[model samples]
Target: MASVALAGCGKSNDAAKPVAAAGAVEKPTLKLGFIKLTDMAPLAIAKEKGFFQEEGLNVTLEPQANWKVLLDGVAGGTLDGAHMLAGQPIAAAAGIGAKAKLIAPLSLDLNGNAITVSNKVWTAIAAKLPKGPDGKVAHPISAAALKGMPLKFGMVFPFSPHNYELRYWLAAGGIQPGFYLPGDLAGTTGAQMQISVTPPPQMPSTLEAGTIDGYSVGEPWNQAAVKKKIGVPVITDAEIFPDNPEKVFGMTEDFAKKNPKTVQALLRALIKAQQWLDAEGGKNRAEAVKILAKSQYVGADPEVIAASMTGKFTFAPGDAREAPGFNIFFDKFAGYPYYSDAVWFLTQMRRWGQIPTDKTDQWYADTAKAVYKPDLYLAAAKSLVDQGVIPAAAVPETDGYKAPQGGFIDGVTYDGKQPNAYLAKFTIGLKAGQTVTPAGVK
Candidate 1:
């Protein structure tokens, strides 16, 4: 338990009036881990705004070097919980990387990523792009613009949304982003464009050095590229898949089972933080940028952080556009852990050959239910509603599955109930009953 005590609280406050009742918390002090990304805003906001203290929790928000380190810290108990990728808990639960029984009780936000191409690659693609009457490249530029170009792209992790979104975008354009075969984890078996792993912070420099032609990553890295005159953001993930689930607040199942009350309290505070972040048409976004720019937090320049956080993403140096829902936190029921979101990620994993065997649609549903604990999310939401912290309508009433959504750039409808059928609709990715080897898909 390596923990730094947050200011304004100490051991002396342990005797102060508790939120629920004295001795209600099984664990009072906690350390949560996060990577240096803007999507980790809820955790930062919660800690900074005393939401955690209001719930009788003493939280220390620790910034990990990267997503892998952050996930491992939560698994090993070094961190009580973490701001995790939507796929991390699913991948770990399926024994993909560092196997652990991690559960995501809350979804952090929706759609905070963009695909950025290096200046050279952008220049080439821009030449082919059709301009509108305003003399700017069309919004939601298709991946087809970069077709036939020999390029290498980078993502933050193997099982990250960045990889899947980028792959989906390329494949939609008839470009093979590649597959992950067993014993060959490089993920470039039959790729038209080679894909590699690069830390989020290093994406701009890596692109500048011509190591990777483009990259799909979350903010403020994408915004950082435009600020540095190294890359141009072609499209946001919201364009690829509207309101796509990005990150989740994940914890080891054991921790949740052991500290039920504490987990509830933590969720309560986080929900409030999310509401605040998305409140008033983003009135507090500027203040959030300042907090996230702190040395101990995201540690990025405030201007770069504000580029996307303030509802206007800088696609190019002077091409800023209005993107109100760019970084949705609490609106549209963003905090609720929808199982359909988990099933969608699993479909991508299977589509990319991460799951080396065929699975039933029921398997997808069961796995999603196991990792995405919407029951717990509802409980937390109910608690908040009881306390009048949030409106009842803010929490959706359902069986944990969202209605069939058809916002994918490829124009394919993902029902979540028919994963294999949805997967078979893709002409690029591995289909059902197909397995990938070092040689190729067999």
Candidate 2:
């Protein structure tokens, strides 16, 4: 096993180590894949800050060409685990990928995604936002403002949260958002929607060419719009899915079962890294940006990363606002991977015809328990907690989230235990055994 030194508050956990340390097991070296984006910060942070080493893990961090390549790496086991969309694992297990079971011991990070509109759309919408108390135009400009305007926006991929999130925000706010052509709807034919996959780096140029009016992507592309003055970032993913779990560290379920301790140790180290990020109450953000800038990872300018990661964001030309917690890495109970968060992703799967038939609340729970291993997280937490590494208060009960989840842009109250009821509440999209079958399937 690789020897990893773990500490918190800059104090060595040697005393607490023996108290909470689990049995020393063989540490397997892992090559993890990630797409170059700010939300991938947790993996970079964990690797750079020696959190992985502390948990007796030897980890290799690699940048992926795109989301498809990243998901393929983990599914094929060329890479052991990767920073993957929460939906990727769900889609994979439900036979979307290779029909393999993928597990997430840790959710990599949260809330660094946004939908940016072209210059024309921004100019069109800018006329409508309420002139705020500060003379700056109001934010979270509702999609209602885009009514009757023929808009063709871009999303990274069909099954991506970017697509679902963008669609959700538009639908909830009374916009008839256009759809992208889906490559395959589980063998269903005909055009799915208008959304076609545009890489994050190409999103701006595509919009500028009038090929698309807007795009949903993660930073620094969103920040690039502000820095380049080409377009404006209208809504952040946080606004769409408040404190939603964005990415997860995924490994084949067989690997997790065969190498259980390694997965547990990884979670322990990552949790420590996450805790350190918030130490001294989150004064380490600047340092985090530098690590993300190294050529091996995101390879974006540190300033672009810092703009969103820090407390400042540019909505339009010279329209800066204080958007603290916009790309939060570890603060605000964001690290706790709630089953409700898992269910929300599943709900979206059903919403967009990806899931086909509606499933029960228990279906959500079963899928969640299969992918999100809270028991493993608890084991890691217990080890760190008993070692006195993190304050008991810092580590929540690890049982679940608050009974009722709020902060959604929509006025929906989500309870993990009641997913079917939640599905019934939506006005748009499918619900309750509503299946979309291919034209000739019957």
Off by over 4 Å in 1: 1-18
Clashes of 1: 0
Candidate 1, which ten residues in sequence have the lowest lDDT sum?
1-10
Estimate, for each residue in 1-442, the C-alpha lDDT of model 1 and write its tens digit: 0111122221122343446666778998999999899999999888887778778888999988888898889999999999999999988766686678999999999999999998888877787788888999987789998888999999999989999999999999889888888776978898889998898888989999989999999999999999999999999999999999999999999999999999998998888788878777887788899999998889999999999999798998789999988999989999999888999999999999898888999999899888899888889889778777777878898888889999889899999888899999999989877998778888
TM-score of each: 0.95, 0.88
At residue 371, candidate 1 shows an lDDT of 89
Report lDDT (CA) for all predictions: 0.88, 0.71
Quote model 1's TM-score. 0.95
The list of candidate 2 runs beyond 4 A from truth reads 1-27, 177-193, 437-442
> TM-score of the candidate numbered 2?
0.88
